[model samples]
Target chain A: MTTGKGAATRLRIVEAAAAEIRERGANATTLDDVGRRSGTGKGQMFHYFPQGREELLLAVAVHEADRVFEGQQPYLDELTSRAAWEAWRDLIVEQYRDQGLYCPLGVLISDVGRYSPASQAVAAQLVRRWQECVRAGIEATQAAGEADPELDADRTAAAVIGAIQGGVTVLLSTGSTEHLEAGLNLCLDRLLL
Target chain B: MTTGKGAATRLRIVEAAAAEIRERGANATTLDDVGRRSGTGKGQMFHYFPQGREELLLAVAVHEADRVFEGQQPYLDELTSRAAWEAWRDLIVEQYRDQGLYCPLGVLISDVGRYSPASQAVAAQLVRRWQECVRAGIEATQAAGEADPELDADRTAAAVIGAIQGGVTVLLSTGSTEHLEAGLNLCLDRLLL
Candidate 1:
């Protein structure tokens, strides 16, 4: 990481790039647009992203992934009780319901070249972080005797995470939350006592 | 649809486009490449896909979606009993596990502009068809007294479908079948009595 002002400039560039990509798509977005949005000069953009567009895109992808995590705040961290889990699930459903389609997944999958190892790493890390939170919640529920003790927390968390991914992906395609709600409800049914 | 030799030529062009897109990404595959691969002239390509690249891509998206179903043959149709369900689930898992990442979802989401009404219609139709088969299986199992009679087969089917989607999407990111298998198993455990 760069220090002080350099780090801030780099972050500004990344944020600007993310916005440009979101609004105009990666293909349509250019370094000039990002520079204009970020108020960064051509030399500065080159200094930060030495490898140019691809490097800048990776940073934008990371930024988008962070937003996805942040979007599932509060409830995501407090999944100890069944109520909290339900809140988290409903919050997810409502977000997709209201927001139409989630873009981070789309951005990562389409714009970032999901098959590429670098982009996949960003997606994998996000999933791992997400799964870890759910796994901790499962453990907490088990300790409280709210969830079934026989269930494996890690794998089950993986299942629940998968459920959300499938649900959201389907929502993106069908513009409906039935799959998302149903998948979460079923996973919650399995988790809670 | 075109007729006789025209229909054959159109299909040949679509198949060639599908193969070209699969080999080279949508962004990289050109109309010229598709025409050359199909042994069709530029005039013929224009005659078939009057709207050009985007129109051809939509057709390619449908072709890819069809392969996704065909890949899960026989079992997909006969998902009546627990054995069949298990077989179908394993087949899905193994396909991803071996094939690395499923491309049809990628094709729809990335290649065809999943946000557009046209591409999404293809994706929605595939999901609807896929969900219908699973719903039928759930109903059949219920009738045989091997599943819960009170379950809403359609929603449950949606959940199961979501599980598969989540599992596969996660697999694409993390290169692991753990989530896919876990999600499917959890849904199956609830479905099969």
Candidate 2:
């Protein structure tokens, strides 16, 4: 269980670093800058993150990773029928559209995660968990007889996850959500056909 | 048309910058470092990329973008049959697997392209051209009566592209190609269905 004062300060530092990384990118952000923005001294920052910038970044990566599911919540968890699936699809498109091209976790990973095996594991775990949720939804649809039972839930789930990712990647570049919509539509349609 | 000497020198600069960015991430790479790595003086470096680091990165983004299609080779273009599509799919999985987690284009775009319209344009154009090739393949499949005539060629192609992007993104994080293979399989199956 997390305590009050110490936990709050750590949260503040992380939120500030995440914002700095978002605007300036992880590679460009500095501990001093984070201290300036968070109004925390280096001593206190170090107290919270002893390993320094890398440790703080790893925290941000996990925090941002949590948000990937949090942003699509309730809907991401609800999947009993085709209607539920479509609603979730719409929510995903709108979510990424609202977030625009900047992917916080993606920025963190590219900046720091790619180089560190531990950081990479944080990201890898996110992908695995996210795919599992999608896989569960597919299974739910199949159980409801709304989706084809013959479909491989794990593979379909992976493809669906990939489709959304692809769409998000394109959206980041082109500032358009069409591919996201197209991928979701095509994948969802595949279930029924 | 590019002259022999100038073009070679420019190519060297771009190659050096690209390697640095791949290893260090774009934000961490400097023009001076590129000059050092390429064994060129600052004067020569500026002669080729006077706009400095951003310009050099833009060139690298374009270079990496070209490689995306080039690596696929005649297979990407030869999508006249299911055999061709399958071959391209296998080639893609193998290529990305061999290339591993580091994506130079993704790095360049995230670091510099996200803020600059010109850099974003380079990425947008690459995705557009890449998707166009996929659309052509889908159209060819339909023409050959191998795929469902009711399939929306453009949408399907875009979705497939998104799927590949998603798979690649996961691969970059998790160092696994399962999602990529699943996406390709699911999308290709949809065409025949």
DockQ for each model: 0.76, 0.74
lDDT of 2: 0.83
Candidate 2 has a TM-score of: 0.93
Candidate lDDT scores, in order, read: 0.84, 0.83
Model 1: which docking level applies?
medium
Runs with alpha carbons beyond 4 Å of true place in candidate 2:
none
TM-scores of all candidate predictions against the true structure: 0.94, 0.93
lDDT (10s digit) by residue, model 2, range B37-69: 998999998888788877888888888777778
Clashing pairs in 1: A166-B166
Residue-level lDDT of model 1, residues A79-161, one tens digit each, is 88888898998898888788656466566666667677877787788788889999999999999889999999998999999
- Please report the interface RMSD of model 1 to 1 decimal: 1.4
